[model samples]
Target: MPNPPDYSWSVQAQQPVDYQVSMVQGLLDPSNSSLARACGADGVRKVRCLVVVDDVVDELYGDRFRDYFGAWNIEAAWQPAPGDETAKTLEQAVAITEAMSAMGILRRTEKVIAIGGGVVMDVVGLAASLYRRGIPYVRIPTTLIGQVDAGVGVKTGVNHGHHKNRLGSYCAPTTTLIDTEFLRTVEPRHINNGMAEIIKMALVKDADLFELLEIAMPVVDAGMMADRNPLSIEIIARAIAGMLSELEPNLWESVLERSVDYGHTFSPSLELRADPPLLHGEAVGVDMAICVALAHNRGMLSKEDTDRALRLMCAAGLPVTDAVFTAELVSEALRDAVKHRDGMQRIPLTTGIGSVRFVNDLTDDEIERGLDFVSQWAAEHREETA
Candidate 1:
């Protein structure tokens, strides 16, 4: 029994990972060379791409996509999966991975291209990460929400059981190519859905962006494209820049003091539990409203500021109140968030329009009071608007 012969060993290493998030106008257009270059299809003899697109996106631009890829000398395996939140599951990821494998996708050279909204990106990106342990992928976020928030981040996840984003990974895409042209086809409510993340950025880190949202809400509500409304473009640009600035340094979230979590802390449960199934941004809007009330209760934000924030959300057509957001639900969401944040609720709250503070000592009493305050405020605001 020679003391096990000392067989254990250790190795230490450091690896740097960097990826680009480019904003191009017409990424899928046959004439546009940006996507081709981003995927390294320009100089390559034959580039193989396994595209996991949202079913809706495929319906809208399938022929054009095929034409563009063919013109670029790339062999593409196009697979469309439902992009709804209900479809963001492990099963979908497995299907995409299996499809890619059948298409002869090379682990190192061939790329998995996720082309659609946030759900498509999450499922496909997760599949890409799981296959062969890791593989390259590109994100083409079609929805405004995907472009400004989900698409730029280095996170891939799917829902499990009753939890939102319970199954996931920290897999970064090779590149995130955002094209505003895709926003043109998004429905009005979906456009407003994307505004929630922009509003979150404004609430947590950019007062200037908040003011711009105030100005751009009317244009956005009118469903004007960025070309027609310059302010709209400016708003999108500022939101993307703010998100990237916050995420670039904390990609792995090694430091948990994340301002981007302002509206996200308690929204996951709310999003998953709603009867009508609130959109991701809609749930976030409700969560932000609650945090605004909590900040006001703590005297960190003025009543005027709180009302203004809520009003901006209203102008953007986002919901500030939902029947499903009861005190019990709030408590449950907080519990889930606390567990996710390693037992210390790293809840992000806005001290002002553009500043944030994370607190770990939130009491149940405070949550109840905040819920009451928001419910009252929402009632009064709704009457006024009516």
Candidate 2:
């Protein structure tokens, strides 16, 4: 009785005239019965689905999805929070696999549905990839990060300790359902956490996205307030649209080592060192900021461009400092990220506004210098906040 949910938005930014992007949109909680009937499934038959979810969503929207699927006589089997912490373990995946085996789920009969944020999506997507050698799945992203980046991208896998995204595959979802309504129930920290990726997409691909985000900051801040702000949702949806538009082709690429990884190398390394793990987007936010600073140090980025990029992150409350960034940890993580890229490969690094390059000529000392500069900035910020 929540008045269902209204879908509306205004387009403030102009769509690209020369560019074309393909996407399929479905309601977050539409009648699945019609879909089943259209597919020639029994009107009373139960379609098997494995839902992977987290605690927050499970408590709030679980019943809604349950009822929605129940309408279609679909059997929704959920693998709720894997008690053992950490996104990189094989234990939870093994458990889910065992559950699927016990259910006697056939490859064609069962479909994996990911119903949470990045962690849940990664786990579910990986399970779908391994189960019966490949079963289709749907993504119901519950977080801004998941909706915009993780939930849409085909790279799915768990972590391997200090290293990030150490295990994964290129298994794109059959479809993704994104409802801005979901963002209403999310915490501010989570929203801020996802902004990192938005900022990344802006920096790496579209300058217009960065500019539009700047214009929408007032609305974003208001959404962070006790009350909801409409514009924030619009901005997030717009950002997702822009990202999807830019990244759709790369969505199914076998090697994501280049196109999708911009500041990720530095960011993931920082995550490993933080006492409390940094959100994926937060790490990327910090890394993007540091990359700007490093680009300036290397004489690749002008001071004006650096300031502009950093200020935009600050306006959105995205982390732009390495206050928690440590030299030793950064070195190790960068090494790991570099290794993840597979040898002295040409890694993408930005030089100017909207300009990026894949250069293998960077020395370790240059990276250390970049980390040092951001470390100093982080220290200054801490003092100011304190």
Which structure among the candidates has the greatest lDDT?
1
Compute each candidate's TM-score over C-alphas: 0.96, 0.82
Each candidate: what lDDT? Answer: 0.87, 0.67
Candidate 1 per-residue lDDT over residues 1-386, each given as its tens digit: 46666677799986577889887876777789978876678834778888888999999988888888888998888798999998999999999989988998888888988999999989988998899998999999999899999899889999999899999998899999987877888998899899999999999989999998887677675257435357877788889999999998988888877899998987898899888879999999889999999999999999899999989988888887788888888888889888788778898888999999999888889988998998888788875333
- Number of clashing residue pairs in every model? 0, 1
* Candidate 2 Cα RMSD (Å): 12.5
| Inter-residue clash pairs, candidate 2 | 88-159
Q: For candidate 2, write residues 1-386 as lDDT tens digits.
A: 47878899987863221222122233334543433432224647656766777767889877876776766677767767642227546666667777677767677756666777888878877877788777777777777787777777677887676566677776766666666567668787778777778777777767766777778765573244223354554556666776666566555443544635777767776776656666777778777876787678878888777777877777667676655676565566666766666675446666676657766776667767877776666566663312
Worst 10 residues of 2 by lDDT: 15-24
